[model samples]
Target: MIPDNEDRDDNKVYFFFTEKALEAESNGHAIYARVGRLCVNDVGGQRILVNKFSTFLKARLVCSVPGMNGIDTYFDELEDIFLLHTRDHKNPVIFGLFNTTSNIFRGHAICVYHMSSIRAAFNGPYAHKEGPEYHWSLYEGRVPYPRPGSCASKVNGGRYGTTKDYPDDAIRFARSHPLMYQPIKPAHKKPILVKTDGRYNLKQIAVDRVEAEDGQYDVLFIGTDNGIVLKVITIYNQETESMEEVILEELQIFKDPVPIISMEISSKRQQLYIGSASAVAQVRFHQCDMYGSACADCCLARDPYCAWDGISCSRYYPTGTHAKRRFRRQDVRHGNAAQQCFGQQFVGDALDKTEERLAYGIENNSTLLECTPRSLQAKVIWFVQKGRDGRKEEVKTDDRVVKMDLGLLLLRVRKMDAGTYFCQTVEHGFVHTVRKITLEVVDEERVEEMFHKDYEEDGPHKMPCPVQSSIPHGAKPWYKEFLQLIGYSNFQRVEEYCEKVWCTDKKRKKLKMSPSKWKYANPQEKKLRPKAEHYRLPRHTLDS
Candidate 1:
């Protein structure tokens, strides 16, 4: 139940759902997303209608995209609805998640409605029809004394306090006319979010009202049937004079394409609860550490929950005392990193030092370089500085090279590809470097030299391999000799390479290694496994 009833005659309880259209045959509209309202303090009607609601009113909820030829693509099926209550009990924000089942035009949309508009719709005219052959139109009949849906408030004449003593004409009018004429349109007169991709439809939604530096912004966490949740916000563009929808984050809650069936938000913990048939997940509002330890990355992310607190990207806690709040910087609307992140000065080498990612490629073999921006709206650009000339050049695409969502793909890497690759992204006129990749292409000669080096005389250079060989009579394995030169960091990779090239079925190598600690796993089995599950998650945990 909503409505505090400050200026109105009654408090109301709102309803949102989808049902078969009344004029389905005439208009060819199969279904309609609807919003209904009923008086909360309702008394049973008189003799003709006893123990029934006397003030039920329903209105059409339209969500559509304007198409050509004066026709619109309508999202008629409502999948989910979220009512966000504010301080005003009467006016709450209504978020409707809608989808269409049209075979040719598969789509999903998000529509927002306000309580005032809904109340106006209920207070407007009613849809009436005289006969089966007649079209439905606004009724021009006489209204009752106290109105059909009015409650017995103190201001509206306190004569008859009960339904039994009320006028029969008002009861009859309320029973017959339940449908309103004026359809309740969305706040923007269109859908705030529309997805026509045939892959998945939006299943559920939860919203959090955030009070930013400018004003309160509604952040939407919309769950999809494909196991992904999209964090979105709407902003009004002053330049274009239109409302723009911005996607703040996209988190996959499940590895498989499991539809999200239920969701709830925790106000005290700042957590979102997601549920599927097989798994459940507790997602945080902000993953500040993933945005990189830089002022530019934190600011460019534009996450309302995150801010640069002069040292690191962290959850922006708006303190009431106001002393600690001045140092935090966050720009959710513009994402103007250069302007907003002026506290940290980028000198010269520190920018590249912050994002150090080294990649190795083999000669005449394929290699992939990954670089992903925090925001999906940003444009990724790859640049390379050659090792010999040290001149920067843009990485142009061709048949051998292609840009994908993950990163850049090099079909056949050559020795000349050895350089320093930079991954930069531009979003909202703010150019920020995502990462710096140091590419080192190793050929057959380098590989042979690395693995075939002679064992040093000193003990300081060895990787201290603890592999206990059962074959005591055989020659010492090449890995121990190579381990003396290669260091501990690259031992496992080199070991795998040497084992693949040297071992066979007849002489399948077996080395008793140190047992690793694992949870819910056997130490004997974990010793032979690739790696131990050092930090095992809950068995029912879903994907991030």
Candidate 2:
């Protein structure tokens, strides 16, 4: 329940649901979303009404899109409602997920409403139906005393002690007229998020108010019919006074394609728990490592939970310890990687290493060079550095060679095609080198001969081709010892050595003290008096 300020601290109550429209519109019958409120102090009228609510009010909640000819496409079917509490206790933001019931248009929309706006709507003019024709119009006639839906309390200058003391005219007016003239409009007069795609039919939603570097952001975790939870946030552009919705991640929590029934977010623990019919799952608030370890990738992600921490792409906590308040770079508004990661990019391979591969093909056979980008939205760009002068040229598609989604394919492997290939991705105007590969075309007949010669020189475990690296003359590749340790004989030797070592850890002890310090510490009181003086109860005195 959300807080509603009234005369009493615990006097207000709110109810939300979808029901058939009472008044007929153009259509015969259609469901309309509504929010009704009641006051706890209302005691009904003494004469006209015996026992009923005198301060009950209700108004329509609009969630729709403007269509042609002034007709609005309404998402009238209510699916879920989430109240995101803010620092202001009385007025929490309302997030309502709605679906369109029209057969011609199937879509979902998320409408945001504020408590202040809703309160104002209830206090506006009341809708009245009069005359023989019974046309509904704003009641321009005189309103009854003390207002029809006003609560009787000290807040109104102690006007009326209770609804029982009010006149019969005011009490009867509230019973007959409950609808308000002005309906509550959404924040921006439109849905905050609208989806007309076929793959999505939103079911439930949970929102978390987050504090980031720039400002507070409301992150919404909406569950769908396909068992996927969408993590979305709204970015407000100050210059344009507009809101931009960004879907940061789409997590498939269930594999059975079942509907996600419920979702909960723990801001303290930084986790989201999702539950479906057959399964449940939990995920951390931020998966910083998925953004890649480069400063460019981290900044481009536009995730408020992560930032470039000078050394790596790490979780960014705006309320973290002082040590974490370092000058990390995060640009959520623009994701300007060139401005945020220009000279601050890591220099060594430890933090900024790219994926490398060694691909080989026979003299006449075909070969496929594979590349995988970090994001599905990225555009793959290929380049080749075949020139000896150390210049790179863009790889153009041809009859014998072609570029594909994941990589490039060669129809025929020729010795002249041997060179280093660079696979890069361009996304949001930022370029990143994701993969580097060296293409080698060897003779079909001499393949076995080359393997035999390398085996005799470098041992059978070595790679069939000559190893290439810039390692120091006396040192081997960093993984050489690891490769040697996995042999059959060495594995057994390692296992035998491990058997000689045993764990010395004890089960557990809540608290422990050393024997040497026991003498200096206070002695334990093992034996206590059966009846301590202070523990005895006070005796009662006889009274006359």
Candidate 3:
């Protein structure tokens, strides 16, 4: 909310957007952006003004790009807004992000508006209607006594001294001519940023005041439709005498290409909370490690979220044990050749020492094997190696097999279920084994005892961990068939029969019920043609 400073005693104002009431009759359901004001002292608006606001005024907001030769491009939907207050300015300026409603011109635009302009539009004029069920137009005749959408003040005392006493003519003007005639451009007199790529549109905008090495800068954190957040800043180029927009980084928050619906930044904590249709994710504003191993790369990035700590590119200034290490520019960029920084050593076999092996189920009982990934960007792969097979097979979720939020749940365990099961996370071409459980099918009593012992031995960090994987179960039928036909048995139906005997004589014997019904046809006895009587004419012709 920005206050109207021109009238020192006037109430502060807030801006929002909503669809027009008559939008159903328009070419498209155009949205109306509006600015509303409320008195600072009005709390609960009680007594004489019960259930009523004495000083409340709102007008439509028109934030469109100026067109060539009076033909303007209107962005119907207001996506997001920010009110930036500076030390030099009395009132905060409004920065709004907008998008078009039509699918044909799918694009996004950024518009900046001044608080004074909005106040003037509200105080200027009211709209008039020539006939019923008609559109509203600016009144041509003399304006009314007290202006419409004007708040009550001691300077201009009127009836009740509030917007409530404003006549229908004034109220209609506020409603009709709420839009400003001129479009507020960015620093370059154009949109600050316009993205025409159809793949991902901008959704949320968050600005943080950053104190970089050079000076203070307002960094824009823009969330997009592809679950990615972009760090951008506007730099004033003195030589060119123009404003240039620079993108610092493109950060991926979600593995799946889901749109980011909401974003909030905490400068104090240096963390960003992102909300999507299915889940909410927290991302550290600066992941210096992801910037790669070069010192030049790290410093040249000029990311307010990250800093070069001499020894390494880090989220924070390297201190404590890291302070004494000799600094190098290409440490991280050279793959951390010394293996000193984070992620340099993969925690693989070290985890196996603490792994748990337990008997979990009876001949026909359900059991769960837990595995969770360290990073959401990684994909989880489950591996099962039954006893004596000496071969590992990729596990797939199916009827008797189900995958829980963090782990695989085997509905019914057979004798062959005894095996070493593994869950590994694949990220950035690196595989790290997250969990390993050697499963064994045993009696009910042993199963219970083993599970109890396993739970007791597990440390605090291993219980009820958050599931970090979202593997898709349903794929194309032909794709699944192709995977199965090529003996590419990685993700296939792991039935007891299919695993033990699929193409052997044992399978045929199982299909043939009793010994009496079992008949073996010799290869010589098998006839290639139809019955000899039906093929007699063809046989006679061949013989002749």
Give the best candidate by lDDT. 1
Which ranges of candidate 1 are over 4 A from the true structure? 4-9, 24-26, 67-70, 130-132, 254-256, 278-280, 320-323, 346-350, 354-365, 412-420, 438-544
* C-alpha lDDT of all candidate models, in order: 0.73, 0.72, 0.55
Root-mean-square deviation of each candidate, in angstroms? Answer: 7.8, 17.0, 21.4
TM-score for every candidate vs. truth?
A: 0.78, 0.70, 0.48
Point to the candidate with the largest TM-score: 1
Q: Please, what are the lDDT tens digits per residue for candidate 2 over residues 1-544?
A: 4445544723567888898864635335568898888777777789876887877878889998877899898999889998887778888899999999889979999999999888898889998887665656787888888788777767655767888888888888888888888888898777888889777789999998876676677888899998777777777666875667777766766656789899888888998888888877887777777676678877777778888888787887777666666658888767777788878746421335666655656777888887756554567888888858788889888988887754888887888888889998786788878778877566765665655655687676653222335445786433333323234454543332222121111311112433332221111211211322111001111110
The Cα error of candidate 2 at residue 261, in Å, is 1.7
**Candidate 3 clashing pairs, residues 3+ apart or interchain:** 126-173, 127-173, 293-332, 293-333, 294-333
- Tens digits of per-residue lDDT, candidate 1, 179-243, equal 88889988867888888866577899999988776566888998988887888888877587577
Of the two candidates 2 and 3, the one with more favorable lDDT, higher being better, is 2
Per-residue lDDT of candidate 3, residues 321-357 (tens digit): 5443334222211122223233322222132232343
Query: How far is 433's C-alpha from truth in model 3 (Å)?
Result: 33
Off by over 4 Å in 3: 5-9, 21-32, 36-72, 85-90, 125-141, 155-188, 236-243, 293-295, 305-544
Sort the predicted structures by lDDT, highest score first.
1, 2, 3
